[model samples]
Target: MHQYQFSLVFFTVLTQWALGSILMISLYRAATGGQELNNSKLTAIALWLICGFGSLCSLAHLGNPLQGYYALRGLGSSWMSREVIVFGGINGLTTLWLLTHLVKGKENLQQTLGLITGVCGLAAITMTGQIYYAVEHQPSWHTPLTHIGFVSTALLLGLATLALVLRQSSKEMPAGFRALLTASVVMVFAVTWQLAQITGLELNGVLVWYRVFASLMVGCGLLVMAKSLNLHSTAMVGLAVLLMVSGEIAGRMGFYGSVLGKMPW
Candidate 1:
Protein backbone atom coordinates (compact mmCIF):
# COMPACT_ATOMS: atom_id res chain seq x y z
CA MET A 1 0.00 0.00 0.00
CA HIS A 2 1.02 3.57 -0.69
CA GLN A 3 1.20 6.39 1.84
CA TYR A 4 -2.46 7.33 1.60
CA GLN A 5 -3.66 3.76 1.86
CA PHE A 6 -1.41 3.25 4.85
CA SER A 7 -3.05 6.23 6.46
CA LEU A 8 -6.45 4.76 5.73
CA VAL A 9 -5.55 1.46 7.37
CA PHE A 10 -4.78 3.15 10.67
CA PHE A 11 -7.54 5.69 10.21
CA THR A 12 -10.26 3.10 9.87
CA VAL A 13 -8.92 0.47 12.25
CA LEU A 14 -7.91 2.76 15.10
CA THR A 15 -11.00 4.94 14.92
CA GLN A 16 -13.26 1.94 14.80
CA TRP A 17 -11.32 0.44 17.68
CA ALA A 18 -11.85 3.53 19.77
CA LEU A 19 -15.51 3.71 18.83
CA GLY A 20 -16.08 0.06 19.59
CA SER A 21 -14.31 0.18 22.97
CA ILE A 22 -16.41 3.08 24.23
CA LEU A 23 -19.58 1.50 22.92
CA MET A 24 -18.82 -1.73 24.75
CA ILE A 25 -17.84 0.14 27.90
CA SER A 26 -21.21 1.85 27.89
CA LEU A 27 -23.00 -1.41 27.20
CA TYR A 28 -21.09 -3.13 29.97
CA ARG A 29 -22.06 -0.40 32.36
CA ALA A 30 -25.70 -0.65 31.41
CA ALA A 31 -25.68 -4.43 31.61
CA THR A 32 -24.17 -4.40 35.08
CA GLY A 33 -26.24 -1.44 36.18
CA GLY A 34 -23.52 1.17 36.56
CA GLN A 35 -20.84 -1.03 38.01
CA GLU A 36 -17.69 0.99 38.46
CA LEU A 37 -14.38 -0.29 37.23
CA ASN A 38 -10.84 0.82 37.92
CA ASN A 39 -8.88 2.81 35.35
CA SER A 40 -12.04 4.29 33.91
CA LYS A 41 -10.43 7.72 33.64
CA LEU A 42 -7.36 6.33 31.98
CA THR A 43 -9.48 4.44 29.49
CA ALA A 44 -11.32 7.60 28.51
CA ILE A 45 -8.07 9.49 28.07
CA ALA A 46 -6.58 6.69 26.01
CA LEU A 47 -9.60 6.55 23.74
CA TRP A 48 -9.51 10.30 23.24
CA LEU A 49 -5.88 10.01 22.30
CA ILE A 50 -6.68 7.25 19.83
CA CYS A 51 -9.40 9.33 18.25
CA GLY A 52 -7.03 12.22 17.89
CA PHE A 53 -4.42 10.06 16.24
CA GLY A 54 -6.96 8.47 13.90
CA SER A 55 -8.14 11.92 12.84
CA LEU A 56 -4.58 12.88 12.01
CA CYS A 57 -4.16 9.73 9.91
CA SER A 58 -7.24 10.73 7.95
CA LEU A 59 -5.81 14.18 7.33
CA ALA A 60 -2.55 12.64 6.10
CA HIS A 61 -4.51 10.42 3.69
CA LEU A 62 -5.80 13.55 1.95
CA GLY A 63 -2.28 14.08 0.49
CA ASN A 64 -2.30 17.71 1.58
CA PRO A 65 -3.08 17.75 5.25
CA LEU A 66 -3.40 21.52 5.24
CA GLN A 67 -6.20 21.36 2.66
CA GLY A 68 -8.15 18.53 4.31
CA TYR A 69 -10.73 20.96 5.58
CA TYR A 70 -11.89 21.26 1.97
CA ALA A 71 -13.12 17.69 2.26
CA LEU A 72 -15.96 19.04 4.38
CA ARG A 73 -17.28 21.01 1.42
CA GLY A 74 -18.86 17.94 -0.08
CA LEU A 75 -21.07 17.18 2.89
CA GLY A 76 -24.13 17.66 0.71
CA SER A 77 -23.17 14.70 -1.51
CA SER A 78 -19.99 12.87 -0.67
CA TRP A 79 -19.86 10.01 1.76
CA MET A 80 -16.24 10.94 2.47
CA SER A 81 -17.36 14.40 3.49
CA ARG A 82 -20.11 12.95 5.62
CA GLU A 83 -17.61 10.62 7.27
CA VAL A 84 -15.40 13.52 8.19
CA ILE A 85 -18.33 15.47 9.57
CA VAL A 86 -19.70 12.58 11.58
CA PHE A 87 -16.28 11.74 12.95
CA GLY A 88 -15.87 15.31 13.99
CA GLY A 89 -19.11 15.08 15.89
CA ILE A 90 -18.02 11.80 17.43
CA ASN A 91 -14.79 13.35 18.61
CA GLY A 92 -16.56 16.31 20.14
CA LEU A 93 -19.20 14.22 21.84
CA THR A 94 -16.59 11.85 23.13
CA THR A 95 -14.66 14.73 24.61
CA LEU A 96 -17.74 15.99 26.44
CA TRP A 97 -18.56 12.52 27.68
CA LEU A 98 -15.06 12.14 28.95
CA LEU A 99 -15.37 15.42 30.73
CA THR A 100 -18.53 14.24 32.42
CA HIS A 101 -16.66 11.27 33.79
CA LEU A 102 -14.13 13.60 35.38
CA VAL A 103 -16.79 14.98 37.65
CA LYS A 104 -18.74 13.19 40.37
CA GLY A 105 -22.53 12.58 40.49
CA LYS A 106 -22.96 12.81 36.71
CA GLU A 107 -23.71 9.16 36.08
CA ASN A 108 -26.98 9.89 34.34
CA LEU A 109 -25.45 12.44 31.99
CA GLN A 110 -22.43 10.26 31.31
CA GLN A 111 -24.52 7.22 30.32
CA THR A 112 -26.72 9.30 28.05
CA LEU A 113 -23.74 10.84 26.30
CA GLY A 114 -22.08 7.47 25.94
CA LEU A 115 -25.16 5.93 24.31
CA ILE A 116 -25.50 8.83 21.89
CA THR A 117 -21.83 8.72 21.00
CA GLY A 118 -22.04 4.99 20.45
CA VAL A 119 -24.93 5.41 18.01
CA CYS A 120 -23.12 8.18 16.14
CA GLY A 121 -19.96 6.09 16.06
CA LEU A 122 -21.94 3.35 14.29
CA ALA A 123 -23.06 5.87 11.66
CA ALA A 124 -19.48 7.02 11.15
CA ILE A 125 -18.32 3.47 10.62
CA THR A 126 -21.15 2.95 8.15
CA MET A 127 -20.14 6.05 6.22
CA THR A 128 -16.55 4.83 6.12
CA GLY A 129 -17.74 1.53 4.59
CA GLN A 130 -20.11 3.34 2.21
CA ILE A 131 -17.19 5.31 0.81
CA TYR A 132 -15.94 2.07 -0.69
CA TYR A 133 -19.33 0.49 -1.32
CA ALA A 134 -20.43 3.42 -3.49
CA VAL A 135 -17.95 2.56 -6.21
CA GLU A 136 -20.28 1.22 -8.83
CA HIS A 137 -17.65 -0.25 -11.13
CA GLN A 138 -15.65 -2.09 -8.47
CA PRO A 139 -17.42 -5.36 -7.99
CA SER A 140 -15.15 -6.35 -5.13
CA TRP A 141 -15.85 -3.26 -3.12
CA HIS A 142 -19.41 -2.69 -4.29
CA THR A 143 -20.80 -5.65 -2.41
CA PRO A 144 -22.71 -5.45 0.85
CA LEU A 145 -20.00 -7.66 2.29
CA THR A 146 -17.79 -4.57 2.44
CA HIS A 147 -20.10 -2.98 4.96
CA ILE A 148 -20.48 -6.18 6.95
CA GLY A 149 -16.75 -6.67 7.04
CA PHE A 150 -16.09 -3.15 8.28
CA VAL A 151 -18.66 -3.33 11.05
CA SER A 152 -17.56 -6.77 12.16
CA THR A 153 -13.93 -5.76 12.20
CA ALA A 154 -14.84 -2.78 14.35
CA LEU A 155 -16.78 -4.88 16.84
CA LEU A 156 -14.08 -7.52 17.04
CA LEU A 157 -11.33 -5.01 17.61
CA GLY A 158 -13.50 -3.09 20.04
CA LEU A 159 -14.39 -6.16 22.10
CA ALA A 160 -10.76 -7.23 22.28
CA THR A 161 -9.73 -3.76 23.39
CA LEU A 162 -12.46 -3.55 26.03
CA ALA A 163 -11.33 -6.87 27.43
CA LEU A 164 -7.86 -5.49 27.88
CA VAL A 165 -9.19 -2.38 29.59
CA LEU A 166 -11.39 -4.35 31.96
CA ARG A 167 -8.55 -6.73 32.72
CA GLN A 168 -6.61 -3.82 34.12
CA SER A 169 -9.06 -3.60 37.01
CA SER A 170 -9.64 -7.27 37.72
CA LYS A 171 -8.44 -10.44 36.11
CA GLU A 172 -11.86 -11.93 36.69
CA MET A 173 -14.05 -11.69 33.61
CA PRO A 174 -17.10 -9.46 33.51
CA ALA A 175 -20.53 -10.99 32.95
CA GLY A 176 -21.26 -9.80 29.40
CA PHE A 177 -17.67 -9.49 28.17
CA ARG A 178 -17.34 -13.16 27.28
CA ALA A 179 -20.61 -13.19 25.40
CA LEU A 180 -19.65 -10.12 23.37
CA LEU A 181 -16.27 -11.59 22.63
CA THR A 182 -17.86 -14.75 21.31
CA ALA A 183 -20.32 -12.72 19.24
CA SER A 184 -17.52 -10.60 17.79
CA VAL A 185 -15.57 -13.67 16.79
CA VAL A 186 -18.63 -15.14 15.10
CA MET A 187 -19.28 -11.91 13.24
CA VAL A 188 -15.72 -11.80 11.96
CA PHE A 189 -15.91 -15.40 10.77
CA ALA A 190 -19.16 -14.74 8.97
CA VAL A 191 -17.80 -11.63 7.29
CA THR A 192 -14.63 -13.40 6.18
CA TRP A 193 -16.60 -16.30 4.67
CA GLN A 194 -18.92 -13.94 2.80
CA LEU A 195 -15.99 -11.84 1.61
CA ALA A 196 -14.27 -14.95 0.29
CA GLN A 197 -17.35 -15.86 -1.70
CA ILE A 198 -17.87 -12.40 -3.19
CA THR A 199 -14.28 -11.37 -3.85
CA GLY A 200 -13.21 -12.93 -7.12
CA LEU A 201 -10.44 -11.63 -9.40
CA GLU A 202 -10.06 -8.63 -7.06
CA LEU A 203 -7.87 -9.99 -4.28
CA ASN A 204 -5.02 -12.45 -4.35
CA GLY A 205 -5.85 -15.95 -3.11
CA VAL A 206 -2.77 -16.13 -0.93
CA LEU A 207 -3.45 -12.79 0.72
CA VAL A 208 -7.03 -13.79 1.43
CA TRP A 209 -5.97 -17.01 3.11
CA TYR A 210 -3.25 -15.19 4.99
CA ARG A 211 -5.87 -12.86 6.41
CA VAL A 212 -8.11 -15.77 7.34
CA PHE A 213 -5.30 -17.60 9.05
CA ALA A 214 -3.81 -14.66 10.85
CA SER A 215 -6.97 -12.82 11.79
CA LEU A 216 -9.61 -15.50 12.00
CA MET A 217 -7.65 -18.58 13.01
CA VAL A 218 -4.76 -17.39 15.13
CA GLY A 219 -6.61 -14.44 16.60
CA CYS A 220 -9.60 -16.56 17.52
CA GLY A 221 -7.33 -19.17 19.03
CA LEU A 222 -5.76 -16.62 21.31
CA LEU A 223 -9.16 -15.35 22.37
CA VAL A 224 -10.24 -18.88 23.12
CA MET A 225 -7.18 -19.40 25.29
CA ALA A 226 -7.88 -16.19 27.13
CA LYS A 227 -11.45 -17.24 27.79
CA SER A 228 -10.71 -20.85 28.62
CA LEU A 229 -7.74 -20.18 30.86
CA ASN A 230 -9.63 -17.33 32.45
CA LEU A 231 -6.35 -15.46 32.39
CA HIS A 232 -6.46 -12.09 34.05
CA SER A 233 -3.24 -10.81 32.59
CA THR A 234 -3.38 -8.73 29.40
CA ALA A 235 -0.80 -10.97 27.71
CA MET A 236 -3.12 -13.34 25.83
CA VAL A 237 -5.71 -10.71 25.07
CA GLY A 238 -3.00 -8.30 23.93
CA LEU A 239 -1.59 -10.79 21.44
CA ALA A 240 -5.04 -11.51 20.17
CA VAL A 241 -5.55 -7.81 19.57
CA LEU A 242 -2.32 -7.54 17.60
CA LEU A 243 -3.20 -10.44 15.31
CA MET A 244 -6.76 -9.25 14.84
CA VAL A 245 -5.54 -5.74 13.97
CA SER A 246 -3.06 -7.07 11.47
CA GLY A 247 -5.76 -9.15 9.83
CA GLU A 248 -8.04 -6.17 9.51
CA ILE A 249 -5.22 -4.19 7.90
CA ALA A 250 -4.64 -6.94 5.36
CA GLY A 251 -8.35 -7.11 4.61
CA ARG A 252 -8.47 -3.34 4.05
CA MET A 253 -5.55 -3.60 1.68
CA GLY A 254 -7.45 -6.15 -0.37
CA PHE A 255 -10.54 -4.00 -0.24
CA TYR A 256 -8.59 -1.10 -1.76
CA GLY A 257 -6.40 -3.24 -4.01
CA SER A 258 -9.52 -4.40 -5.83
CA VAL A 259 -10.09 -0.93 -7.22
CA LEU A 260 -6.72 0.79 -7.00
CA GLY A 261 -5.39 -0.38 -10.35
CA LYS A 262 -8.64 0.40 -12.11
CA MET A 263 -9.08 4.02 -11.16
CA PRO A 264 -10.34 5.83 -14.26
CA TRP A 265 -8.29 8.92 -13.63
Candidate 2:
Protein backbone atom coordinates (compact mmCIF):
# COMPACT_ATOMS: atom_id res chain seq x y z
CA MET A 1 0.00 0.00 0.00
CA HIS A 2 2.77 2.42 0.88
CA GLN A 3 4.56 1.46 -2.31
CA TYR A 4 1.41 2.15 -4.26
CA GLN A 5 1.19 5.59 -2.70
CA PHE A 6 4.74 6.36 -3.69
CA SER A 7 4.17 4.97 -7.16
CA LEU A 8 1.06 7.09 -7.57
CA VAL A 9 2.99 10.24 -6.73
CA PHE A 10 5.66 9.26 -9.19
CA PHE A 11 3.06 8.40 -11.75
CA THR A 12 1.37 11.80 -11.36
CA VAL A 13 4.63 13.65 -11.80
CA LEU A 14 5.69 11.47 -14.72
CA THR A 15 2.35 12.01 -16.41
CA GLN A 16 2.77 15.78 -16.06
CA TRP A 17 6.07 15.57 -17.84
CA ALA A 18 4.46 13.42 -20.47
CA LEU A 19 1.78 16.08 -20.94
CA GLY A 20 4.42 18.78 -21.28
CA SER A 21 6.26 16.65 -23.83
CA ILE A 22 3.10 16.13 -25.81
CA LEU A 23 2.36 19.85 -25.67
CA MET A 24 5.87 20.71 -26.75
CA ILE A 25 5.72 18.35 -29.72
CA SER A 26 2.27 19.57 -30.59
CA LEU A 27 3.40 23.20 -30.51
CA TYR A 28 6.46 22.47 -32.58
CA ARG A 29 4.38 20.45 -35.00
CA ALA A 30 1.84 23.25 -35.23
CA ALA A 31 4.48 25.91 -35.81
CA THR A 32 5.90 23.83 -38.62
CA GLY A 33 2.37 23.44 -39.90
CA GLY A 34 1.95 27.26 -39.98
CA GLN A 35 0.18 27.44 -36.61
CA GLU A 36 1.51 29.82 -33.94
CA LEU A 37 1.92 30.22 -30.15
CA ASN A 38 3.35 32.69 -27.69
CA ASN A 39 5.80 30.13 -26.44
CA SER A 40 7.01 30.51 -22.80
CA LYS A 41 10.45 29.11 -22.08
CA LEU A 42 10.09 29.20 -18.29
CA THR A 43 6.82 27.32 -18.30
CA ALA A 44 8.30 24.68 -20.54
CA ILE A 45 11.42 24.23 -18.40
CA ALA A 46 9.53 23.89 -15.09
CA LEU A 47 7.25 21.25 -16.58
CA TRP A 48 10.29 19.37 -17.81
CA LEU A 49 12.00 19.50 -14.41
CA ILE A 50 9.02 18.33 -12.33
CA CYS A 51 7.94 15.67 -14.80
CA GLY A 52 11.46 14.40 -15.39
CA PHE A 53 12.21 14.13 -11.68
CA GLY A 54 8.90 12.39 -11.13
CA SER A 55 9.71 9.76 -13.75
CA LEU A 56 13.13 9.14 -12.22
CA CYS A 57 11.53 8.49 -8.82
CA SER A 58 10.12 5.22 -10.17
CA LEU A 59 13.56 3.75 -9.70
CA ALA A 60 12.79 3.88 -5.97
CA HIS A 61 9.82 1.57 -6.37
CA LEU A 62 11.69 -1.19 -8.20
CA GLY A 63 11.91 -4.30 -6.01
CA ASN A 64 15.18 -5.44 -7.49
CA PRO A 65 16.60 -2.15 -8.65
CA LEU A 66 19.61 -3.71 -10.39
CA GLN A 67 17.48 -6.15 -12.34
CA GLY A 68 15.32 -3.23 -13.48
CA TYR A 69 17.51 -3.01 -16.53
CA TYR A 70 16.41 -6.49 -17.63
CA ALA A 71 12.72 -5.45 -17.55
CA LEU A 72 13.15 -3.79 -20.92
CA ARG A 73 13.99 -7.20 -22.39
CA GLY A 74 10.26 -7.90 -22.36
CA LEU A 75 9.17 -4.84 -24.36
CA GLY A 76 8.31 -7.16 -27.20
CA SER A 77 5.50 -8.56 -25.07
CA SER A 78 4.38 -5.53 -23.03
CA TRP A 79 4.15 -1.76 -22.85
CA MET A 80 5.44 -1.82 -19.26
CA SER A 81 8.68 -3.16 -20.63
CA ARG A 82 8.90 -0.26 -23.06
CA GLU A 83 8.15 2.12 -20.20
CA VAL A 84 11.20 0.90 -18.33
CA ILE A 85 13.35 1.50 -21.39
CA VAL A 86 11.83 4.92 -22.09
CA PHE A 87 12.17 6.12 -18.50
CA GLY A 88 15.87 5.36 -18.68
CA GLY A 89 16.13 7.25 -21.95
CA ILE A 90 14.34 10.22 -20.38
CA ASN A 91 16.92 10.38 -17.56
CA GLY A 92 19.82 10.04 -19.97
CA LEU A 93 18.45 12.79 -22.19
CA THR A 94 17.78 15.02 -19.20
CA THR A 95 21.44 14.68 -18.27
CA LEU A 96 22.29 15.61 -21.85
CA TRP A 97 19.86 18.53 -21.75
CA LEU A 98 21.65 19.94 -18.71
CA LEU A 99 25.03 19.55 -20.38
CA THR A 100 23.78 21.18 -23.57
CA HIS A 101 22.45 24.17 -21.65
CA LEU A 102 25.76 24.49 -19.81
CA VAL A 103 27.53 24.63 -23.16
CA LYS A 104 25.31 27.53 -24.26
CA GLY A 105 23.07 25.30 -26.39
CA LYS A 106 25.65 24.69 -29.14
CA GLU A 107 25.74 20.91 -28.65
CA ASN A 108 24.18 19.06 -31.54
CA LEU A 109 24.55 15.88 -29.51
CA GLN A 110 22.25 17.38 -26.88
CA GLN A 111 19.86 18.63 -29.54
CA THR A 112 19.40 15.14 -30.98
CA LEU A 113 19.10 13.68 -27.51
CA GLY A 114 16.48 16.26 -26.62
CA LEU A 115 14.21 15.14 -29.43
CA ILE A 116 14.43 11.50 -28.35
CA THR A 117 13.99 12.49 -24.71
CA GLY A 118 10.85 14.43 -25.50
CA VAL A 119 9.27 11.45 -27.20
CA CYS A 120 10.26 8.96 -24.50
CA GLY A 121 9.21 11.29 -21.72
CA LEU A 122 5.66 11.36 -23.01
CA ALA A 123 5.76 7.64 -23.70
CA ALA A 124 6.82 7.00 -20.09
CA ILE A 125 3.93 9.03 -18.74
CA THR A 126 1.39 7.46 -21.08
CA MET A 127 2.59 3.91 -20.43
CA THR A 128 2.75 4.43 -16.64
CA GLY A 129 -1.00 4.96 -16.55
CA GLN A 130 -1.59 2.49 -19.33
CA ILE A 131 -0.13 -0.22 -17.11
CA TYR A 132 -3.38 -0.33 -15.18
CA TYR A 133 -5.48 0.18 -18.29
CA ALA A 134 -4.02 -3.07 -19.64
CA VAL A 135 -5.37 -4.92 -16.58
CA GLU A 136 -8.50 -6.84 -17.50
CA HIS A 137 -9.70 -7.37 -13.88
CA GLN A 138 -10.64 -3.99 -12.49
CA PRO A 139 -13.20 -2.59 -14.90
CA SER A 140 -12.55 0.92 -13.56
CA TRP A 141 -8.89 0.53 -14.36
CA HIS A 142 -9.59 -1.23 -17.65
CA THR A 143 -11.15 1.78 -19.34
CA PRO A 144 -9.54 2.43 -22.70
CA LEU A 145 -9.84 6.18 -22.21
CA THR A 146 -8.13 6.24 -18.80
CA HIS A 147 -4.81 6.92 -20.46
CA ILE A 148 -6.19 10.09 -22.04
CA GLY A 149 -7.42 11.29 -18.65
CA PHE A 150 -3.97 10.83 -17.19
CA VAL A 151 -2.41 12.64 -20.14
CA SER A 152 -4.89 15.49 -19.99
CA THR A 153 -4.40 16.17 -16.26
CA ALA A 154 -0.68 16.11 -16.85
CA LEU A 155 -1.03 18.86 -19.43
CA LEU A 156 -3.29 20.86 -17.19
CA LEU A 157 -1.07 20.79 -14.10
CA GLY A 158 2.13 21.04 -16.12
CA LEU A 159 0.92 24.18 -17.88
CA ALA A 160 -0.46 25.67 -14.68
CA THR A 161 2.79 25.21 -12.79
CA LEU A 162 4.74 26.41 -15.78
CA ALA A 163 2.68 29.59 -15.79
CA LEU A 164 3.65 30.22 -12.16
CA VAL A 165 7.31 29.71 -12.93
CA LEU A 166 7.07 32.01 -15.95
CA ARG A 167 5.86 34.88 -13.80
CA GLN A 168 9.45 35.35 -12.67
CA SER A 169 10.78 35.25 -16.24
CA SER A 170 8.87 38.50 -16.77
CA LYS A 171 7.74 37.47 -20.22
CA GLU A 172 4.37 38.41 -21.66
CA MET A 173 2.36 35.25 -22.48
CA PRO A 174 -1.05 36.16 -23.87
CA ALA A 175 -1.43 33.28 -26.29
CA GLY A 176 0.25 30.84 -23.90
CA PHE A 177 -2.07 31.77 -21.06
CA ARG A 178 -5.17 31.39 -23.21
CA ALA A 179 -4.13 28.00 -24.53
CA LEU A 180 -3.21 26.63 -21.11
CA LEU A 181 -6.40 27.77 -19.36
CA THR A 182 -8.48 26.31 -22.15
CA ALA A 183 -6.66 23.02 -21.79
CA SER A 184 -7.12 23.12 -18.01
CA VAL A 185 -10.87 23.45 -18.45
CA VAL A 186 -10.88 20.54 -20.86
CA MET A 187 -8.91 18.39 -18.40
CA VAL A 188 -11.44 19.06 -15.65
CA PHE A 189 -14.26 17.96 -17.92
CA ALA A 190 -12.42 14.83 -18.97
CA VAL A 191 -11.81 13.93 -15.32
CA THR A 192 -15.53 14.37 -14.67
CA TRP A 193 -16.38 12.04 -17.52
CA GLN A 194 -14.00 9.36 -16.28
CA LEU A 195 -15.45 9.57 -12.77
CA ALA A 196 -18.94 9.30 -14.23
CA GLN A 197 -17.90 6.03 -15.81
CA ILE A 198 -16.99 4.69 -12.38
CA THR A 199 -20.12 5.86 -10.55
CA GLY A 200 -20.65 3.11 -7.96
CA LEU A 201 -17.75 0.68 -8.17
CA GLU A 202 -17.81 -0.26 -4.46
CA LEU A 203 -14.84 2.02 -4.03
CA ASN A 204 -16.29 4.63 -1.69
CA GLY A 205 -13.31 6.51 -0.27
CA VAL A 206 -11.58 6.50 -3.62
CA LEU A 207 -14.63 7.68 -5.53
CA VAL A 208 -15.39 10.34 -2.94
CA TRP A 209 -11.95 11.86 -3.35
CA TYR A 210 -12.13 11.48 -7.11
CA ARG A 211 -15.42 13.34 -7.43
CA VAL A 212 -14.37 15.99 -4.93
CA PHE A 213 -11.14 16.72 -6.75
CA ALA A 214 -12.82 16.61 -10.12
CA SER A 215 -15.30 19.21 -8.97
CA LEU A 216 -12.56 21.27 -7.35
CA MET A 217 -10.50 21.27 -10.53
CA VAL A 218 -13.41 22.43 -12.66
CA GLY A 219 -14.58 25.00 -10.15
CA CYS A 220 -11.12 26.38 -9.75
CA GLY A 221 -10.50 26.66 -13.48
CA LEU A 222 -13.72 28.57 -13.88
CA LEU A 223 -12.93 30.84 -10.95
CA VAL A 224 -9.47 31.57 -12.26
CA MET A 225 -10.72 32.44 -15.70
CA ALA A 226 -13.50 34.57 -14.33
CA LYS A 227 -11.17 36.45 -12.04
CA SER A 228 -8.46 36.86 -14.66
CA LEU A 229 -10.97 38.28 -17.12
CA ASN A 230 -11.98 40.86 -14.57
CA LEU A 231 -8.45 42.29 -14.21
CA HIS A 232 -7.56 40.05 -11.29
CA SER A 233 -4.48 38.08 -12.25
CA THR A 234 -3.48 37.72 -8.59
CA ALA A 235 -6.82 36.23 -7.72
CA MET A 236 -6.65 33.95 -10.73
CA VAL A 237 -3.21 32.71 -9.75
CA GLY A 238 -4.35 31.96 -6.22
CA LEU A 239 -7.36 30.09 -7.47
CA ALA A 240 -5.34 28.10 -9.96
CA VAL A 241 -2.74 27.11 -7.38
CA LEU A 242 -5.41 26.02 -4.92
CA LEU A 243 -7.15 23.96 -7.56
CA MET A 244 -3.91 22.33 -8.68
CA VAL A 245 -3.01 21.27 -5.13
CA SER A 246 -6.50 19.99 -4.44
CA GLY A 247 -6.47 18.06 -7.69
CA GLU A 248 -3.15 16.42 -6.83
CA ILE A 249 -4.36 15.38 -3.38
CA ALA A 250 -7.55 14.02 -4.89
CA GLY A 251 -5.64 12.07 -7.52
CA ARG A 252 -3.22 10.54 -5.00
CA MET A 253 -6.03 9.57 -2.67
CA GLY A 254 -7.98 7.93 -5.43
CA PHE A 255 -4.95 6.02 -6.63
CA TYR A 256 -4.05 4.81 -3.16
CA GLY A 257 -7.61 4.07 -2.13
CA SER A 258 -8.54 1.86 -5.05
CA VAL A 259 -7.55 -1.80 -4.66
CA LEU A 260 -6.46 -3.90 -7.62
CA GLY A 261 -7.26 -7.59 -7.74
CA LYS A 262 -3.58 -8.37 -8.20
CA MET A 263 -2.69 -6.45 -5.04
CA PRO A 264 -5.38 -6.25 -2.46
CA TRP A 265 -5.06 -3.31 -0.07
Local distance difference test values of all predictions, in order: 0.77, 0.56
Which residues of candidate 1, in runs, are more than 4 Å off? 1-4, 104-108, 171-177, 227-232, 261-265
lDDT agreement of model 2 with the native: 0.56
- Clash pairs (backbone) in predicted model 1: none
RMSD of each candidate relative to the true structure: 2.6, 5.0
Badly placed stretches (over 4 Å) of model 2 are 1-4, 18-49, 105-120, 199-246, 261-265
> Candidate 1, which ten residues in sequence have the lowest lDDT sum?
198-207
Tens digit per residue, CA lDDT, model 2, 33-91: 42222343433454457656676566667778778777777877787787777666666
- Give model 2's TM-score versus the native structure: 0.69
Residue 135 lDDT (model 1) = 83
